[model samples]
Target: MQQLPSNSISLFCFFCMLLSSSYAKPRISSPAFAANSCNFPAIFNFGDSNSDTGGISAALYPINWPYGQTYFHMPAGRFSDGRLIIDFIAESFGLPYLSAYLDSVGTNFSHGANFATGGSTIRVPDRILPTNEGFGFSPFYLDIQLSQFMLFKSRSQMIRQRGGIYASLMPQEEYFSQALYTFDIGQNDFTADLFADMPIEKIYASVPDVINSFAYNVKSIYNSGGRSFWIHNTGPLGCYAFVFLYSPSAPALKDSAGCVKPYNELAQYFNLKLKEAVVQLRKAFPSAAFTYVDVYSIKYSLFKEPEKYGTSSVSHTTYGMEEVRINTTLH
Candidate 1:
């Protein structure tokens, strides 16, 4: 149960406050408005496993625990022991946890839908794996996720036009347009390159193209009438168990933070370019309110002070990769 930092929590709260003020009108109000002072109608998320609720489950079932042991008491397709940061954000806004877009049965998506998938990348890489089986390219890359979102919007619009249950809740346009749009991707893109043994320089060089694709997707969503965005930068990849297990550097090259210096540097480089691209995106969409969340700093704090965050060991927060490796090998 890795928790978001207090500062990150406050940041999200501040965003909610801003959203409340921006959407509030003097003329009309409803019971839902009275029930929750800051009633954001919906939330839409795009990301990798960091925010994936159940995309993996819908595609591949019987994923074993301790995946969702903390919260749901059963595997719920999230990569962690409990809820993701996005789940908490949704709860703070008085919205239900978003259902995975691919989840078919018993899913309530009136509030919003999640298009994130495990192992999704920002862009499909040019190089395929060198394995004899010719495997390991992410099928649900950001572009395809955006396309799925477009389809979701279309279907929701059709349902609204047909006077369905969703039409009573909110207009499809408003649902898509007013909902908070969030992006928490790009980690897998770097990880993919790293796993493929691409040169470090070549991996660094891919940042611009990755950010460009991300920015383009943002603009596309803006064109579709989205006006608010919360973008999370990549966290400290070097601190994760996967990095320690598979990509360890020399002890001398480790940072004071206990993370491999080179891997953290790569993450920082990506975050830097991402922030710059977001600045340009703000210029491109004058009406959109873009909030860049510093997830790297927040997550690094957990690594720095695991005890303070209610974890006896840092291993509790980041054993996903280790679990995956063990499970895959066992199967």
Candidate 2:
């Protein structure tokens, strides 16, 4: 696939990096933590903005201020005010931050690269914006991201063999098999379908296909030497003000949390299928470790009881990445 113009691919990646330092605290006493305590040489992430370091920013335009201010003290290309979940995961593993695959200026790929972009989806959509305009859905969808990874894998090695100053930036090939492969995409697929006026039944019908596509990609990555997979289930779409407010529904249709009930139900359905997919992946890739994290439950809790989490807002509607505290018991 041809690369879209940088401006065309630019999009606003959302999601607040609200967890505290305790989220990254090591739990040595937990058997799961102890069993998986080995060092990961690198992290190769695939997703939308939820885990994007700067793929969309580098591909499209720079992420402006207020973003990265809380942590990097500058616009760091992340949608969050501070470090993202990917950053904390890197910190936990003692690995350097994963650079965006598309970033060209001053990038070091010795550790790993992020192949995620804002507005990305697991399944490629039927309609996308014209090449000259910003995309409604990212051109670098999951399949495209995988293709880029394959290309990067081979090209980085080729560049290393040439033995130039650039070679030092490439990862040693063995890192591919040992790196943690993280995913936080698929949310956009549902949102896109919803916004397109696709029938609720039709959207439900598409879930299997979406899950199958995700499985296929994971299998392909496994074939390419990836063994550790950390897949995040999609969050509650209804709780977000963007969805609930824009949706043509009465206030009565909302649940007790003031979120559109149907959207969250759809998200729950998607998560169920996703968990089933992970189970099958575990069975198929016996040697690989597939950890399916339920970020939906964690995110929904905030919306369900904002006061409980010390946040005044029930939804993440504003473009500014606000800080909201969350429990640190994430396994």
Candidate 3:
């Protein structure tokens, strides 16, 4: 097993690094291996709403308005008006859009399929879904989307056998190991239910358990032969639209500008916890690679510095966040 720093050492390193690099921001390497060099065949996705392209919004699950209206001109199945960080990731990989398997009626998924649904959880028996990526927040349980992904992989193999991208790319075993696996999820477990009135202590207590559950699922995928992965973590849930409206008990602070402190703090804490988890996961899964994409940072940057994104508005409600999120989602 690959060993990471203990909590104390990791904390020390984090601060030391922060102090040493305070003058410079963190550098983000490309999300993809160069198409010519990367061995992974097709990309696979798994996650909750933030990474959700259209899983829930399309199913008419009462998503916020103005979602995906900017870039898509209407809801393009994303919480935002445009593409997401994952979309950019696809582009960086020189792959085509990861069409949701649910929307794969006519699209060709030679590249891969997106199994990320809008509301999913890592461990809990989600009223939100059947597998982790819950189904439409509905009454009937849907079959595991993993089944769809397996089918897609099968077809991808056929395409390769017939001298498709697979043949064009590389051999089979290398393809499997090198294939980029993206697991973006767990935000809904923190946000959707808490906003529905779960207690704050309960939320905190559940974090480790939830992370463990997420780890279990990740192990499940690893055992199934997944290698490279993008492990997503819980989101800053209290900042969204209904959060402020429904539960005002945990009272997030705000400046004159009205930035919600409670929400931001909860988000920051979640990010910290997730960062720690990533270190642990990396240690556990050395053969397979994983990168932690801090969506919270990307999302926060867009919200804090609206000018960078070229958008005119800095709205706060879930609707506003989604609007800004849409642009961030896009290139």
Candidate 4:
């Protein structure tokens, strides 16, 4: 895995801190806040590899090298070499790193739980066919992750109702209501379609359905007592090492930034639709605090100006891509 530059890491952490601190403030009149004024107590995350903590590792056992070398010095299930943006966000709130929901051993749920899994998509494709691009199917789609969250909520409520030792802890409603609900999904959904060689117009046509399902899921969380949300739109998929290196495109079609033009256009279109959906959601849930983050621009900055970020390299080598492809297939 390519190491994120120090400057890029700093910017990422700063953004996370801003979002966490801004959204975690208690809304005085909302039921999500307790009588005691406290910083947000927990965070519930849903997404893919970009924010995955250990769901892949917990499900597939140990992952390979270079996955966590930068910080952990060992494979800790993060797709990158060190802490993800979510990890920095947790730290900003003075909370321990959130544990993957599937992880069993040495797991602590006091802070929060991550439902993200590598390869996950907002919606599962009808059928997954192997492509030269090396993408595959993921059973842990957004709906499944949402189901897991609902299960967690149900189990916690059951424990509270039994008057168990945990009952003295924060109430289920207040805990979930005050918790920061974050989403970093939708990339794989579009990527799967692209890898399948679906036409651009067809892929564009699917955006509404995709965002509708996403909106419904958000509403479900709100009905379940969540009051604060931090939703990250899809990043620049065209700028990814695999897409830039392998996707067939004429030299004339490449953008000034050296990214495939069509792919990046699709990503921008999706982000626009997602932002619009968030606006509708804000109006729908007037009591909730919704913050939409433009992750594409942030990540693109690192890709566009690696030297400025103190990184020796930005794109991946052919050997590196092959290695990642093999490891992704193994999972």
Best by TM-score: 2
Regions of candidate 1 where Cα sits further than 4 Å from its true position? 1-12, 15-38, 125-137, 164-171, 248-252, 316-331
Which 10 consecutive positions of candidate 1 have the poorest summed lDDT? 26-35
Off by over 4 Å in 2: 1-37, 127-135, 314-331
Cα error of candidate 4 at position 269, Å: 0.3
lDDT tens digits, residues 128-219, model 4?
32334454644678898999999988776677778855654423556787788889988777765675578889999999999998998899
Task: Rate residue 240 of model 1 by lDDT.
Answer: 70
**Clashes by residue pair, model 1:** none
Query: Candidate 4 — which residues are off by over 4 angstroms?
Result: 1-38, 127-134, 160-173, 250-252, 317-331
Model 2's lDDT to the true fold? 0.73
Model 4 C-alpha lDDT versus the unseen true structure: 0.71
Global lDDT of each candidate: 0.70, 0.73, 0.55, 0.71
Sort by lDDT, top down from the best = 2, 4, 1, 3
* Clashes (N, CA, C under 3 Å) per candidate: 0, 0, 14, 0
Residue 174 lDDT in candidate 3: 43
State the weakest 10-residue window (summed lDDT) of model 4: 322-331
- Candidate 3 C-alpha lDDT tens digits along 3-68: 335542233223323433442322222232222334345677777555666555444454555766
CA error at residue 126 for candidate 3, angstroms: 5.0
lDDT of 2 by residue, 1-331 (tens): 3333454221110011112212431111111211133467778999987877888888876878767765698988777777778888877656788899988877989989999877688899654532443236667889999999999999999999999899989988988987878899887788766755678899999899999999999999999989878788887787665564345663556888877788789988998898888888877877887777778877877777666766565423233111122222221
Q: Which pairs clash in model 4?
A: none
Q: Which pairs clash (backbone N, Cα, C closer than 3 Å) in model 2?
A: none
lDDT of residue 29 for candidate 3: 20
